[model samples]
Target: MGYDLERFVGYVNEGLLCCVCRDVLEDPLQAPCEHAFCSSCIHGWLVHHNTCPEDRLPLDITHLRPLFRYMRNDLARLQVRCVFRPQGCEVICALESVHRHEQQCDYALLNCSNAGCPVQVSRRSLEAHLCVCEYSSRVCSSGCGYTVLNTEEAQHNCVSELRAELDMLRAELDCKVEEVRHEMESRLDSQRRHMVQKESLLRSEVDELKGQLSRVMSDVRILLGAERARRQELERAELEKAELLELLKKEGLRPATPSEAAPPPAEVQRKLSPRSLALDCIKRKNREVTVI
Candidate 1:
C-alpha cells in the first residue's frame, strides 16, 4: 500500500492483477463467486454496492474470503522498484517487501517537522537539517531572553557572556560579604554575652569578698576592745597593790616578840614572800625620812 503501483507497471502478471487498480494484487480477497480483487479496491467498491466488482454477484464484507495460498506465494515473488527511485533510490525489492524498504530508504523524501520550515529533505538529511533549522528555537546560556533560530541568533546581542560572568561573580561576592558580616555579628553577640557573664561573676565575687572583710574587721574591733579592758584592769590592780604596800609601811611597827619573829602562817607566807620582802626594803629606806 505504501509503494506506487506505477513502479510495477510492465512486470505484473495479468492473473495476479486487481481488476479495479490494474496492478499486481496486494492482499487480494476472493468474492463468493471466486472472483479475486485487491482488498482495498473491493472494500472501496463495497462502500457503494454490496456486490462483487467482477461478477456483480451479491456479496458482503462477511462473504469475502482471502486469496488462495498460490496467489500469495506468486505475489511475494513479484519484483518491484523502490518508490523513492526518483529520489535517488536504485534498490529493487520484492513486491511484498517494497513497503519496508521504502520506509527505511535513505533517499525517501521527508518534510521538515518544524511548522515554520518549508524544506523537504531526504530521510538521512532530515536529522542534520533539524539541528540547524532556522525555525527551531533554543535558550540562551546567559539567562538572557534571546531565544531564536541558530541562523538569526547572532543578530540580537542582549547580553555579553563575559559581562554576565562578572555580574554573577559580583553577586557571589556580595553574598559572601553578607554571610561574613552575619557571622561576625553572631560572634560579637556571643563574646558580649560571655563578657556579661564574667562581669556578673566578678561582681558576685567582689560582694562576697566585701562581706568577708566586714566580718573580719568586726572581729578585730571586738578583740581590740577586750584587750583594752584587760590592760585597764591590770593598771588598776597595780595601783591598788602599790597603795596597800604604802599603807603597810606607814603603820607603826610592833616590837618583835619571839612568836612574831617565828615564821608566819603558811597562807600569809605565800601572800607576802617575794613581793612583801621587796616592799619591806623600800619601807626601811623611807623610814629614815619619816623618823626624822
Candidate 2:
C-alpha cells in the first residue's frame, strides 16, 4: 500500500493518489488511460480483474507504464513523516527520502537478533536487549567447540558436547576410510583384469611363436634329410669311380704298362683304335654320372 495520507505535511494532489488504495501513490504506475495507481496495488488488482480500477476500461499488465515525469517529480517532492513517528521518531523528509530516513530511524522496531527470541525491540534499544536475551548464543568458555544459548548455560555439559563432537569426527573418519578402501579395491580389481588380459595376449603370442618354431624345425629337418641323401650319393659315386679304376687295371688298359702290353694286329687296330676305345668308355661313364 502507499504511504498513509495523514503522514504528509500538506495536501497531496488527487492525481497522485492510487486509484485502488486511494493513498498517495508509492512506486506509482500509469495505465494507457492516464490513470495512475501504486504498482503493487495495480498488480494485485490485475490478478482478479484485467481492467482499469478507475474507469473499469479494458486493461492488462502490458498496458501499464511509469508515471509521467512531472507527476513523478511532484510525488518525490512531497513532505512525509517518518514511518516510525508513532514509535517516537519525529523526523520528516521528502517522499523520496522517507524510506532512507526510516531505515536508519532509531525508533524503528527490529526482531531480536537471537534465534527463538520472539521479542521485537526498537533500534535504539536493540543492543541493550541483545545483551540480556535468554536465547542469545556464545561460544562455550570450556572450549567445547559449540555455541551455547544463554537459557541453556546452566544445563550445558562441556564434557558431553566434546565427546559427541569426537564421536562425530570418528564417524566421519571411518566413512572416509571406507571410501578410500573401496576405491583401492576398485583400482586393484581393474588392474587384475588388465593383467589377466595382458597375460592372455602374451600366451596367445607365445603359442603363435611356438607354431612358427615348429614349422621352422620341420623345414630344417627336411633340409637335413635332403643334405644327408646328397652326401650318401656322393660317397656311392666315389666308390663306383674307384671300382671303375680297378676294372680298367684288370682289363690291362693301364697306360703306365704300355711297354708290357702286346700290340694288336693291323686289321683289329684299324677296326678299333686303342685311343678310340678309351674315349668311348669315358663317355659311357660320364653319361651314367650325369643320370645319377
CA deviation > 4 Å runs, candidate 2:
4-10, 19-22, 29-33, 37-69, 85-92, 115-118, 142-146, 227-292
Clashing pairs in 1: none
Q: In candidate 2, how many Å is residue 71 off? A: 2.5
Give candidate 1 regions above 4 Å deviation: 1-5, 127-132, 157-292
Inter-residue clash pairs, candidate 2: none
How many residue pairs of model 2 clash at the backbone? 0
lDDT of 1 by residue, 1-292 (tens): 2234677635566768786677667788877787778888888988999887776778899998988888878888778888888888888877878889989999999999987789999998899999988888777655676675677677756656557777999999999999999999999999999999999999999999999999999999999999999999787668657865655554445433445434545754455546357754655454444444
Q: Which ten residues in a row have the lowest lDDT in candidate 1?
A: 255-264
Over 1-292, each residue of candidate 2 has an lDDT whose tens digit, in order, gives 8889999998899999999999999899999999999999999999999999889999999999999999999999999999898899989899898888888899999999788899999999999999889889999988877899988988999998888889999999999999999999999999999999999999999999999999999999999999999999787666655755554554444333333243444553454435356644664554444334
Model 1 clash tally? Answer: 0
Worst 10 residues of 2 by lDDT: 254-263
